[model samples]
Target: MSAWRWLVTITRDSRSFFFTFATLCGVVPGVIGYGVMQVTNSTNPELEARLRKSARPETVMMGKVNQERLAEYLGELKQKQDTNDRYVAALRGETLTRKPYQRIQPVPKPSDTVTTKAQ
Candidate 1:
């Protein structure tokens, strides 16, 4: 039988169609990606170790800066940390400011008389 005929024969019911499509769409891509990653990551450990030993720790550090640039970097880091702290505090129900005074509706005095509409 042809490919289309074979697919139809295999997926005869909704359950079969669901299972087949799920396997093709989900499992197949996952297996392919895993295989690709394994092949790409297959390397000589000695080469990796040599390369690591050749590189300087400061050079490998993220956004490595000298003393001249340290102040600016620290200021930015502090600002970000403060903002994140405020956000976390707000999440914890800590009020940053006091609530504003609300206006109250005036109540009628007890001495006020009620009038009936009946004539």
Candidate 2:
């Protein structure tokens, strides 16, 4: 009949103890948080005005095509294709030609020096 005795009895069974613990720790807090969120949630007038303004027909317009960006993207695709071709050539044991845009310069090896003294 006492709360302490009821808790002791519930803890004796694993299934009842698990369900009681889950209900108390998980389900109870989740329900309380949902209730609090619902009570506290309210629409802001300024946000509503901004949303209405953005949703107006005058604020919407057709996207303009950028010719420069399109040209740059095409150039990038061509460069990528050229790089893949170079890689394929290298894999086939063929010499790869450097692109005009690339500024790679080969470094020259230092010559060996030898000195002999007359006895």
Candidate 3:
């Protein structure tokens, strides 16, 4: 019905053929553009080396990212606490199996005092 629809129909039925043809068509224009730009190009190896050595920006960005991660960790801690509190609340009516144990003590002796130093 439309030019684009016709193009789509042709492309779908002959996908491999149309794709290669389209790629070739695109490459010709790109090669022409690159060839034209090649006449006006200059490169500086020193500038490239300096740019490669400038790694501080990446390290600073990582520092900022670590702060965000720390905040996320704190948020996760709060969620864990809420979950633990919920578990405690849910078990409020449940009986716990406590270990049976008792401390032993002897009857107190008559008041006694001992001197730490010779008197």
Candidate 4:
């Protein structure tokens, strides 16, 4: 029988068609993916070592807190709190004399005239 005739015959029966369709769409691709994974899979020793090192906990305990770092952190916290407070006050319709937050000014670019003079 011709290939097309055989395919028509198989498709006529629901059970046979389902088995054929499942094998073609599911099993075939699964087998192909398995083969590809097996062929392409590889291990890197350096990457493995790095992964192991990161996974392992640090042996050394944190030393005494540095007073300078603590002070700097506290100052940053205070600044953040002040900014948040100013934002909340503004939301409540309070008039702020000073700017809530300082805006970052763009750096002045060298003019074409300056570049021409330098050249």
Candidate 5:
């Protein structure tokens, strides 16, 4: 067998070992770090005060939406889904049924003027 294929086979054969290794190396350290952060957040009053003072004021906005507006948003989402479906079909070598994309006009740049004249 080729070296690349052999390596892949070895890795596939040792999947459990890799899982245990990752759990020991990555997940354990991440859990420990999160625990340390939580302890610091609870124990350190100065840090907590500093964090609260710098934090943005929370808005009291509620999640209430009108039925008509919600329906309109759902319709827009469905139209986008249809466009995505057509694009995916075209990617898979199927004929496109949608109209040609419109050409975009170039954006005009701002012209900067200065009063300084070169001799």
Candidate 6:
């Protein structure tokens, strides 16, 4: 048999067309995805640069001018804590390690496997 015929026989007789086609569909789109990403990156070089810069996690904010604002905020927070009484410990310059306001959820666990135990 010819190569094409051989491929058809092996693929079809084994009912692997869906598997191969599905795999190709997934892989081809992934390969195509990189190309799309490249095209998009090239098209928006400035945006890409901004995104690259932003991708780094920020621990601290910028501008010394904002310090006064922070103090004001802290003062207001202090007053609020005084009124609340529950959070007085927090306002006393004691650092409060906290859960993030908006956090990325944990990655999902891998799925269970489908097994074949032929008797």
A best-first ranking of the candidates according to their TM-score comes to: 1, 4, 2, 3, 5, 6
The positional error of residue 53 in candidate 2, measured at the CA in angstroms, is: 20
28-119 in candidate 2: lDDT tens per residue? Answer: 89999999999987688998778767774644432123454456447758777444654455566554223556523334344444323321
Clashes of each: 0, 0, 0, 0, 0, 0
Q: How far out, in Å, is residue 11 in model 4?
A: 2.1
Give Cα distance to truth, residue 24, candidate 6, Å: 1.5
How much does candidate 6 score in TM-score? 0.27
Q: Kindly give the stretch of ten consecutive residues in candidate 1 with the minimal lDDT sum.
A: 96-105
Regions more than 4 Å wrong, model 6: 1-14, 42-119
Tell me the whole-model lDDT of each prediction, alpha carbons only.
0.62, 0.62, 0.64, 0.62, 0.59, 0.59
Q: What TM value does model 5 have?
A: 0.28
Highest TM-score scorer: 1
lDDT of 1: 0.62
The local distance difference test score of model 4 is 0.62
Query: Candidate 6: lDDT over CA atoms?
Result: 0.59
The predicted structure with the larger TM-score, 4 or 5, is 4
What is the Å distance of residue 75 in model 5 from its true position?
21
> What residue pairs clash in candidate 3, if any at all?
none
Which segments of model 1 are wrong by more than 4 Å?
1-13, 53-59, 63-119
- Give me the candidate number with maximum lDDT: 3
lDDT by residue (1-119, candidate 1, tens digit) is 69978777667756778697878989889999999999988489998888877888876573345542466447658777443544555576553322226222233444534443332
| Model 4 misplacement above 4 A | 46-119
Local distance difference test, candidate 3: 0.64
Give the better candidate number (2 or 4) by TM-score. 4
Candidate 6 on 58-90: residue-level lDDT in tens?
A: 422443336755775587587774324324534
Superior candidate under lDDT, 1 versus 3: 3
Model 5: residues >4 Å from true position, as ranges? Answer: 1-12, 43-119
lDDT of 5 by residue, 91-111 (tens): 765543223473222334445
lDDT of 5 at 22: 61
